[model samples]
Target: MTLSTDNALVVPHPLGLDYHISLQTPYCILCRYAVRPGEIIAAVFGHWGSPSYLAYTLGFSFPTVAQFEYGATVYEKSRSTSYPWLFCRRSDCYNCATLHDTSIYHIDCFHIISKNTASKRPSLRDIWTIASWTESLPKTRYQAPPDITLGAVADETLIDDHESILARVCSIPQELRDIIAQRCPESPAWRLVSALSRWRIFQPLLDPDIEIKGFSFDDIKSWCRRDGMVAGSGGSGKIRIQLDDLGVSRLDYVNDSPALPTAASRSQNAWFVVEEVSEMQEARIETKGPFMRIHKLPSFHLWDTPVPPDPALTRWNREITGNLRILRIRSIALKDITGLTVFCQHGAVRWIYPHHEETFPGPYSYPCDNSPSMAQLVPSAIESSSVIAIFFPLAKGEKISSVWVRRCEPYDDSIPDTLAVITTRGRFQLFGKYLCPTRPEVHFQQLSGNNTATHLLFQDVDFPFQRVSYFAAVSASVNNTGISPLAPSQLAQSRGFSWSSSFCYVSIVGLENVELIWLFRRQVPEGTPERDRLCLGMMLLYEDGTLAAAGNCRQGPDIDVQVIMLPGSIHYKISHKAGGVAVECATLDGGRDAILGDEEGWQSIDMHSRSEMRFWFDDSRTIWITSPST
Candidate 1:
């Protein structure tokens, strides 16, 4: 029989009985019997009367019908309690009643309905049945085994042009790849791998190559020395090696034989040699037969005359291989190192190195004729002195060659306090001293060849006539005739051509309340134009003894004295105060004005003991200084 939303299905017993059974509506069943909506129909069995006949037609036994009644009663009671229940109906077996919102049935039939829905009545069952079904199902799908038949397949054709080759190499085991990477980092494959390896973030991926076994600090030093590289010990015992030219071959030897000589040689030699043996064992051989043994002898005996040394190995070799000359001295403790100098006379350079523990008995005389060659002056000027300077005469027609130095003595001396030399080509060679103790720090500045004249000024300053001496070196170059010591004042005033000057001023500002004033006058050549021809500057002394100089003073007489260029002359006035010092600059043509220190302006400088100051000016017309009393 078909059932409608508002109709109940009635069926007569098939045993020729007159009695009929009718399912009640859900609402009436719940109200009259006080049963849950889900278990309402199950309660109708109480009105069935003679359940044997109804049960026989439905294929259920008498005891099963009683069990259904008992289960329905328990489920309805459970709805009143806090526990949840599942309900099913024969007509809508797929739709099961849920605890929340009875109108919304549970669509997952496996979770709510029994396996044999036909045998059991649509009534509430045990709440544990839902959980039992869930446990019976598998957690995940079954996985198939990998195909071992698909061996190492070639994927080169599948890789796009944009794909990185290093990424493919990384997929291989790192243990096998690391050895190849470390041993030959210059290989094409390694270069590509290293380029991509830089971006790896994990520690395991970074520098995967193992450390080389036999590479040591001594090996590194030997390689550097052979290749003319720089190797030295740094702070905290760290070693730093720098290769100026990587094209030079590194020294690699095995058993007194050169290994990996060059890229070309390495390719031909197969780079490395390997030996394989199935077994290694000690063996001894004994022979009883007499045999004649002959040994090859040298062509000449020890008593024979020895061959002469090669001229190329001698100190006076004259081959003009290159124009660069280098002189290096290893280690020596020369007290008067400042007195050393290399003078270039005619077309040769001369330098002196005294023997160990030997002192000059008297002052050595230099060549009187400045243009004399080494052959003419060596015998007359330096014959008596044991501290004779080594002379290197250039080729007869060659210009003065450039001289370079690798290493020398006075390792802690930064500036070479030696005499300057003027080459025959009219170029100046400034001496440079390095301060590096573990390594060489050579400093060489090529002087302009166009400079016609150069001036050397040695000034000694002493405050309060103290015994402590302060020496300052100032070099000035001009495009005019060179000046002698006696005619410095006259040369300063001479003006025949337009000229430029460069000078450095160094001074130690004493602790006393002395007003240090510096006066600079620009000496314009007589015929030169006067528009903006003069510039002035002042060096401010810091409490730490370092100097800071300001140039082109244009602003005001500010608190921190501002420097300005006046047409005639400019001077710096420094006064020592209690907490700080005051500096002022003014033109010679006007009355002096005092500038007060302020926050936005130049703050007062703290005065300290023996504060030092230095100023360097370049491309100036002329500069001079004046000292003042405290």
Candidate 2:
């Protein structure tokens, strides 16, 4: 890789008129955990970074190109792990075990910190809050490159050869690879070479073989509206991703987070349904990396057409076929999702509750770009402010029984916004947005465990496009359910708190709920006049159906006298009395009253560790039971 006199410019400013040297892309590393925003950062760095720090983070001035844009100057000679088409391929190693964020680095690595060069450079949620505090040990991943023959692709040749992966998958032809091989027929060929080098589809105006040859057959039957065809649409059950297709310094990465979340289908998959209404595009992390822009509101503009159709593929082809016939009469699959919402209309809409898919690649959208904005969330100037509101309505056969997310914050360390979830028969889905409704915040930072959510974790940092600071939800289960031998004497026995007396404390934080669908008790109305009156009030439907209170109940949700409906996989034990309100009991399954429901008495843990959940209040208000937290 030593051939890089380091000019890495792709569009590094100065009237970027056909400038060159981005050796067909690789270095997107400014540490966006799952990088892929703007391109250009080539890094074959032998003499080590600093071409004026890529001209002050790519601003301009490299003037000297009498027409140049060839290729193959990324110094070849065989370095392994083939780095293929990236706009998404960063598997976090900020808690470095060998510096692994292939979005390249070295302007003083963590952005200049020679023991402290005027501080401030953390953000990527401050290095994922110290890499979510302590977690490097996974080491032993082949290792090798401490310089045996002193590498840099010692001579370079493995661009995953075969005429360079067939000149990068025949520039997306074979009719856009049979329309992206019928929308990912069991992906891998890094999902068709990272969706044809991430829709840069050899750019001749986003080439579908030179400006879409009218993709025909209803754009490959409206982007493979499911049927059956999984065996690797590229043939021979494709796998190919050994790494280094053209530099990601020596690959092997993955401590987990190889990347691929949204992009169900699209070869113009009929913009699915486009009335397109979303606008906030403030943007930061800079250098062409965050354009969630898609301004095209008032559509079809009162047609007076004589002969005009292709306004970017026939103005959404008849309203995406009337929204795919209203998504086939709302037949919503993916188990009809049920709930998951994220407020802020003109620039954030985490939809998914029957409104399942038409596009969902949040945070400055990147299910591999081409955006005409079909609602890819994350933009907030405080319009709706409802952190993780709804997806509420669900009755017909009602079945999402449970799934969770609540990280809350309006005080303390600040910037967490708020979130929450529940179901089986409606009336609880209140994670956020329903026309701007959000007013309860007694502190709830984490919970997730009533199943059905293979994955949905938006911990804040939107790629290198940072600053959205909050939105947390984590759920994964069907087997392994450990922890709760009453967790380390219930977080080291503070279940009897006194933190040096003086009273007035409240921390109802259910950090990692193991399950509990509903229970918003607010007692003392028995025979009225307050029966023996220590009159406790309560609220807590966590594990997603966030309904706070418990210490600050304040007679709301219509005085919740008692709404007990538990069983999100059982294991409840909440005894209360934290300085006032008074909640005495919420028992089930475990064993300070029988909790360990088996699985070898559970204690497995290791979910990438690092967990801490707080909730302390005394006057005998000690509710205790645990499922997650290290």
Candidate 3:
């Protein structure tokens, strides 16, 4: 017998396993209390008639039946002193299941209510509606219309086409053929069903008014006969017809029906028609814009300069390649430092880390920690360096002490002559150490529009001096003609020199808030014809992003920033503040110079060029030599 879609009963019990089984078969019970709706119970032993069954067969009153079910009985008593017969000692509650059992009494009445509850059944329409609404869907069915089309359907061909897939299914491997057959059975063109199943793909079609009529297996067979090709004959004299490529191509068309338009599709004037309600339910809306949102700008990678090797410069060549290692050190003392200053010339200014202990630490002093506070530079000019002078501040009763320089070898081993010792009357005896530079290159000062010209002075030495050479160029930034001050003969006052250690000074004709960092190196060692050791130089910080650097010779893995040429004039304004410090700057043409304006304000710095700047802060004390005129 065929299962009717309607009239399908659903047991009310949450777990109705036994009740379902009983519906499928038959069973007997002892009494109403013998079993629950969903519980399993054994049949009576050797008894064909149960309590209720026996009552129905024996014509007993409801109360009699109930008493028997409870293992009770009735008897009549004799004369006036006694009953005619012996009656049941236990009283019987009438079975409310029948009218004869009803009485004017306070009874639970729940048993009667249960009978009515059990009799109430669900209608065929309700079952069908619920099933349609709550059914789970298969994956192959489209749940929504995708913004970007699925790759599978993009190249699909019409089934009616001779070369289409329906025809090709027969030629495909048995496994693939079986998979397709299981998915799309040759039956009713249930486009609505398919559409509803793919709700995501056809959500716009979701409406109470939408109706889909189902078709029978015979109807599908006729459709297949008209469209699909009969591939072979079966064992039972039946024709085994396979959906040809042409027939399959026409399947979607045949199933097509009016579809509700999606918001996005409607805006774009797009319309579609699908066959099954399920297919319509699964329909999706497509947006015209991008499939995925793209949100940020591409980043740029900076290329590092290659380092050259020179045996003569070995003493100043301390750097770890490809590693930014963290090191621990002591904090710099303010008393042992000197020459803590900010100078401005032309349209530029820089805090110079000259021989000041805070500016440049020698070997004997304790190593100071280089941190964020020590290396911050803002309103930066070209190649700027901030030097802090540290020395022991004289105390009322404390006596001054002697200070010495410390030294070390390549392996961090102590070298007696690494630094020089000195004596002062202040309570603190140690020297100063500058912390950081602005940026790695001299690119900054040029941006501020400063002149970069310098004259160098050096010690006369022999072969080693001859082995070393120097070059200089200058930029005046006048008439929009970028003539740099770095040229060897840019200014008559500018000095140039060649020896183990060198020095030079350039004037900034134009450019504001400018700074200069001087590069210094030793080409010769003591006892030798030349003195190849570390030297000391100076750098200025600018308010603008530019920086300026000048000195004897710069070291490798240098952190000093470089200046780039621009097409404008630059100038600076310098002012002296209280406490022996000054603000040196070459802001813009008419811009005011930037420096410490008040006697009391927290000053932070830029350590952008700290790598090279750190050289001055190191214990070696040899990045720059003294100026000849000084």
Clashes of each: 3, 35, 176
Overall local distance difference test of candidate 1: 0.22
Residue 610 in candidate 3, Cα distance off native in Å = 32
Reference-based lDDT, residue 10, model 1: 20
Arrange candidates by lDDT, highest first: which order? 2, 1, 3
Residue 461 in candidate 1 has what lDDT?
Answer: 11
* Model 3 Cα lDDT, one tens digit per residue, 79-118: 2222222333332211011111100100111121122232
Cα lDDT tens digits for candidate 1, 278-334: 110111111111100001111110100012111121111111121111111111112
Per-model TM-score, in order, reads 0.17, 0.25, 0.14
Per-residue lDDT tens digits for candidate 2, residues 1-630, read: 122223343213333222222321222222211112232233311111111122122222211111111121222112222522222122221111221211232232232222222333233322222221111111111111111111111111212334543245444545565555454322223222332232221122222243212111111211111221122222111111111111111101111221212333222111112111121111111001111111111222111111112222111101222211212111112255433333322122233333343333234221111122211222111112222222233334444433333222353122223233445543333332111112244233223334443333332211112112223222334231221122111212232333322222233334235233223333444454221223233334445544333222223233344343342232223223222222223243322223343323222322123242223332233233233444
Candidate 2 scores a C-alpha RMSD against the true structure in Å of: 22.6
Comparing 1 with 3 on TM-score, the higher-scoring candidate is 1
TM-score ranking, high to low: 2, 1, 3
Off by over 4 Å in 1: 1-574, 578-582, 588-590, 593-630
Off by over 4 Å in 2: 1-40, 43-338, 341-393, 397-413, 419-426, 432-461, 464-630
CA lDDT scores, all candidates in order:
0.22, 0.25, 0.21
Instruction: Name the runs in model 3 displaced over 4 angstroms.
Output: 1-630
